[model samples]
Target: MVSSKLENEPTGKKLPRIEIRMLSFDLVERVEIARLLTDAGYSVRNELAANFDRFESRVMDDDWDVIFVDARVPYDSVSRALDLVRAIGSDVPVFALVDSHQENQADLMELGIADLFTSDDLQRLPGIITRGLEASDDRKIAIEARRLQNEIEFAGDERAVLAEIGRLVSSSLDIGQVYDQLVEQVKILIPLETAAIAVADVASDSVTIEYLSGRELPGFDRGRVMAMSGFTSINQLPQFVFVFDTELMEQMRTEFPGIRELLNAGVRSVMVAPLVHRDEVVGFFATGTSTENAYEPEHVAAVEQIAAQISGALANSRLHIHISRIARERETLIQIGRDAAAAHDLQSLYGSVFKNLKNLLPVDRGVIALKGEDGKSLAIEYVEGLDIEGLRVGDNLELLESSTAVLTGSQPVTVDNAANREPFDLTDGKLITAGLPSTMRTPLRARDSIVGLIAVSARDDRAFTQDHLSALERVSNQISPVIESLSLLNQVQSLAAAVETTLDLFAITDLQGVTSYLNPAGIRLIGLEEGASGVGVDLKDFMSPEQAEIVSSIGLAQASETGGWQTEISITPRNSERPIPVELLLVPVRNPSGGPGREVTTVNVFMRDLRDREALQVELREFVLTVSHELQTPLT
Candidate 1:
């Protein structure tokens, strides 16, 4: 049958469209029901239930907000149609329509009828439908509110976990302790069966596992160093890498073999966040689980937050370590200086140097070589560790590639593999033969000149780093001056010994005529005790008035201009009544690069006693006179 179409006209308020199905045997009653619902702002479809097929087809065709069945229809047909609605799992409220008060209201309710009404009460249908829909909307609102409350609580917990992690990171400079606490806090946020921190070593181009928790993976434990090339490049990774399944893990396995151990440890999923500081990736924070697809977007985000906090703390700890190391190196340098100053001999000085240098750098073998007198060869002053057949402490070694390079460049040189390079001298060949492959050498510079070289070696290749080279260079710079000063002191001591034993009087007087040093001979010539020091005596005290006047007027002036002056003088001896005649020479001692205008620092006085020579000459003349007088007497 063709259903009547009815449309609601526009009103002051918009109302929700409600669809209703009408069941009746009479076509007149169906049209009446459709008109009433249409006027009341509901869309309606009418179904005839003369037989079950017609009623079931209409009910299954559309989703209805309400189903209306008239009691005038055959009781059996209405009952069967209600049964059909219930069998289809439709929750549409069903209202039974009665023309007379003949049907039992209780029986209709038992059959799942929503309400009982007749043609007189047909007007109340719209109000009943409105209240039902309002009640349904209220239930939906309550469900959504509970879901939002649960989400808010979950977010609050996550924030609490992050705040605690931040607190842990800021609490200590000890990185290990902070990491341990950090992993525990992270476990609360993510379902982690394993967690680890790997630190990258930029100098060595390697990564080392610094901390591990949970299941231990073989060959990938803490302190294990692996080449950085064995893992995925940190720069290419996202903020956090999430290997959610075995498929993705397999895809990443080819480039990162380090993850294979995780798989073997029953870790099927993983999340990794790179620890970045100052825009550079320095390490990684990783978490894994035994269940595939265990990590969610929220878990990835949590790890990233933790990684950022850890990165800042790790950077601070590393900086602290670096500064402490520098402080220790400075202290080592100071100790080396003290050692050099207190050393009594060359051997003691070298021993002190080696002992102090070991604190700053690796020194399995140490050698100290100074330039020879000829300036063409280096004499080994000290050697440790290497034992060569012909190489000894006093052996002279020709300037070779390594030492020459250090001298010429005035910088440190490092040989990662000494055996791989061609030997330039016997010392280099001996080092290679001794199985020492790594070496660092720096020039020992003194007074703006390369005086020697200091070298250290190790048995392992690539054992020394640029920092070691720099440390050796600093040590060389300090040691060079001490060595030079010691050499000058030795020379001065030998010269003083010779002057002390000479018979000729040697005296050093300041420009003001005060004696600074009088050698033993000079002291004896002045009639002082053998062990007496003449350091505070005046030069004029032991000279005659005329000689003192000559020295004050002409001797000092001539020496200042011409570097030396000589004169015959008489010295009055303190222990004797007579005066001693002597030939005196005065020489001005000036700076090393002395010129005519340079100031004289002191005067060197050389005196030769003339009394003995004069006495000899007198005796010879007397003998000649006596012999001549005897001859004259005999001839007369």
Candidate 2:
């Protein structure tokens, strides 16, 4: 029946062309099958005429999409052919020819055969083989589609996970909370025995653990954290891992020699990613996996994305916390300023500024100093966490000559590595000697003038960002005004000395007639006790009944507007038993201006001795009378 069907098939364009490889033990059967398939418009690669030893080579030379294995051939030969196909990694499908009596489908499937056809089913062989070829092509397409879909899904999942972590980090303003969430989320995504984040302490050339996840690191020290050498340094942490194999000499020589022992010590495979901010490698995240090839390219890529988010989040969180701290400190410092304003003692104000700064900023030690003449020395005024008696306050320390050379020169200065920089002192070295590694010094400036400086020291080696620098600048800027106010009062005291030369009793008062400045002459004239300061006394307290009323009225009018008055009044003299009349002159002293804002105004009073003026008048009258009498007598 199979032979009749093959013969009846027309060999024309209407019928599909099929290539057949017929394997048979008998030459007659091979000839019959070939003649039938050829008559059916099929090409045949018959191996019956070939020797068994050269059969596989002959079959391999032909590029048939399917191979038919005859049951008559030795099972070992068929197995060898299947092995060859697999070894070559060919996509060709193998079908087995079997008898109905020996229908061992399981055995054919186990032998790596694609399908089986019995001798009785020979009539349907062409169609079955054609369908098998089509099915094989479809399977290939399906497999490729699945592989591509897997890759796309993997990439999309990575992006989604990274986005979720980013959202989680940004939603929280708290740094510790963000870190905790980051660690937990990473664990949920990719389970690991231990994970930790370390940041580069650039000043010290070491990385500190910023976040930790999973199991506690074995042999982890609290006071002294775990550190890695060459491969684990901040500069090189971006590399995933460099593995070595001692058991495989070829692998050892080909990759990493003498590195097997290093891997065996809880360092089989290390996955590391760097955290970058402002173009700097601030830190790195690392995890250790026990399995070889534990981290693939996709895993590394995911970690890199997470690390980027962590870098940005940490930078933002730290900045936020820093701003919050600075704002609180600013409020406290402003309160201190208000308190200082009410004080007459400069010592109190200096104490308040220093105390507030030390309490607010994270510092192991601090010092407050002012620039001396020639810009050489820093006159230390206040200090904390230092040996006070050992340090001199007013002595010259010989600092930088150029204002531009100094870091804290009318601007906030931060020295991350202070010990390695210029104008830094190891003299007292309490900071350096105490193993302090970081230092920041900000110059106090008021109205563009460098009034003083504030220095903070830390034991940790970390560079200050622009924000921290700005915060310290603000703190110093706030205190500069207080220092300027004190310095102004000192200048006023020196000017008061020159005013003492006027014995006519000069006095300076505020807009309210409150005597703010009184020279030695005025103090003595008012019968004030010796060495008594008259800063708070009113003009009415010093003047006699008549003089007080006249001075008060004129002082009030002058204080309101730029007005002056000259009047005569009676006053009780300090050294005399009688009441002496005096002449008083009042003038409103306008502040020097024309640069920025409204100027300050004060009242200046000048007093003249009335007794002396009266005596001179009497003498002039007597001289006139004498001259007149003499002239009249001569005329008569």
Candidate 3:
């Protein structure tokens, strides 16, 4: 039989050769295929269709444009050869050459054969070759197009995942943020039914499921710790890929069921990548799909890259947390320093420390204890925002504890738990009664001497770190100077005797008009007996009726305004019927909280008698009047 072979030209010029390889059953079919393609301008060759293994390699290796197979071969069956090329993952097309129709002829067509040809149709051989070349070319173009599309889609998905990863690295609050972003991004790489990230704690010999996304598996809430050797085995391997049928899954469950709960629900295939940083395995990211054999090699590689990124991201998150904590501590101490600088008394100073305490450190309840005036005990000087039984202001306790060491200029005493153990005995029952189980006592120092103690407390299990102690030390340092200044007030008061002994009359008064203290000179000037009771008397009572009303107005106005005012006024002494002149100066003390005399606490009054000046003025007036009357007598 001869098939139609269309000749191009008889012009002796050789056409470009088209190469062809054919799989034939016997010698007859081999010669037929060779001549058919040869007359059609294709250079043809023949191979004995020896075995299905060699058949698959040749077709899949891209050497042939079209493969022609005989319906029967000496050693192997046609159906088996066709199955090798199509049922598996090869893309080359195969056609069958049938000699006669059989009972299974229709069944052979359904076995993924590309086309069928019979011996009677030998004339159509050239047509079949022409059509096969055209069809193969079309399929190659389509496959190339699909491959490019997949690459582009993968690239787009990578960009989106990396963008989200950038956000996680830059703004992550905790490791949980990194976990959240990692699991969500894993689903983009493959068909994911469920995904999880589990971190292994070596010391605890446990695996902690840190984050999970998609379908929830029973007994796999976050933070659940499992005692399993599977995580240990996973850590030993850099990566593990598991694909299971129902039988294999059951086998795995029997072998390692302890960690089976950590696996994804309905998982048929899963890829696990180790989260490694600096050569240490910190955790693993598990991505699972319910579809059988769903994960490919490329998917495993993609998950490996994500796990690597998460390792670095987690480290950065910890650094960010530390930096934010330091920044907050600095701002809080600066505010406390400003408040302490304005404190003029111990009470306001204590209030400022407590108000800003929580800004720098955790404080649920706090107290400031200082050595009492009794000199043998420490007293509760300042306390609030805490409900401690048997503790109040002025309550005394023996100063024999680690806090007493603060009086000797020692470091602060700290306790992690107050119920069973504490640094000092004096703090006994204080924490349990206050509902606080953690306590820290920082010393308040003035002029290199311990002036008081600051105690901060929190709920049980609140462990204070060294960083927290450092921050508290910064706050205590800022308030030390204010305490030093207040502690020196007794030395300041010792100078008052100098003012008292001077000939000047010095008096001190409250914001009201009544005098609080009167120097001896002031007492004598007001006609009160020396060392007599003049403290309660108002200065207005000794002034003449007109001067009293006028100077009283001047003094009241001086109290209302800040600074000082001075005037000379006449006063009728209580012991004498005549009025005497005196000089008076009123000065308002500074208000601690700011502004002018609105909150002023006291007024300072200085007085000096003007009796000598008034006597001289009277004599001069008499001399002037004498001369005037003499001149009016006409100088005879």
Q: Encode model 1's per-residue lDDT on 393-475: one tens digit a residue.
A: 88988865464654554332224234445323336577657777567777788878888888887765556656677788888
Model 3: per-residue Cα lDDT over 205-272, one tens digit each: 56667678887777666655665475336445444544344455556775676436534356666666
Flag regions of model 2 displaced more than 4 Å: 1-175, 178-293, 297-330, 358-360, 373-375, 388-396, 400-404, 407-416, 419-430, 488-517, 520-636
- Backbone clash pairs for candidate 1 read none
TM-score of each: 0.51, 0.46, 0.44
User: What ranges in model 3 sit over 4 Å off?
Assistant: 1-24, 50-69, 72-81, 99-108, 175-182, 232-255, 262-265, 318-636
| Model 3: residue 259 alpha-carbon error in angstroms | 5.6
Model 1 per-residue lDDT at 475: 86
Model 2 C-alpha lDDT per residue in residues 393-445, reported as the tens digit of each score = 55444565443345344322233335454555523454555666556777778
- lDDT over C-alpha atoms for residue 186 of model 3: 61
Number of the top lDDT candidate: 1
Between which residue pairs do clashes occur in model 3?
3-123
RMSD of 1: 17.9
* Candidate with the greatest TM-score versus the true structure: 1
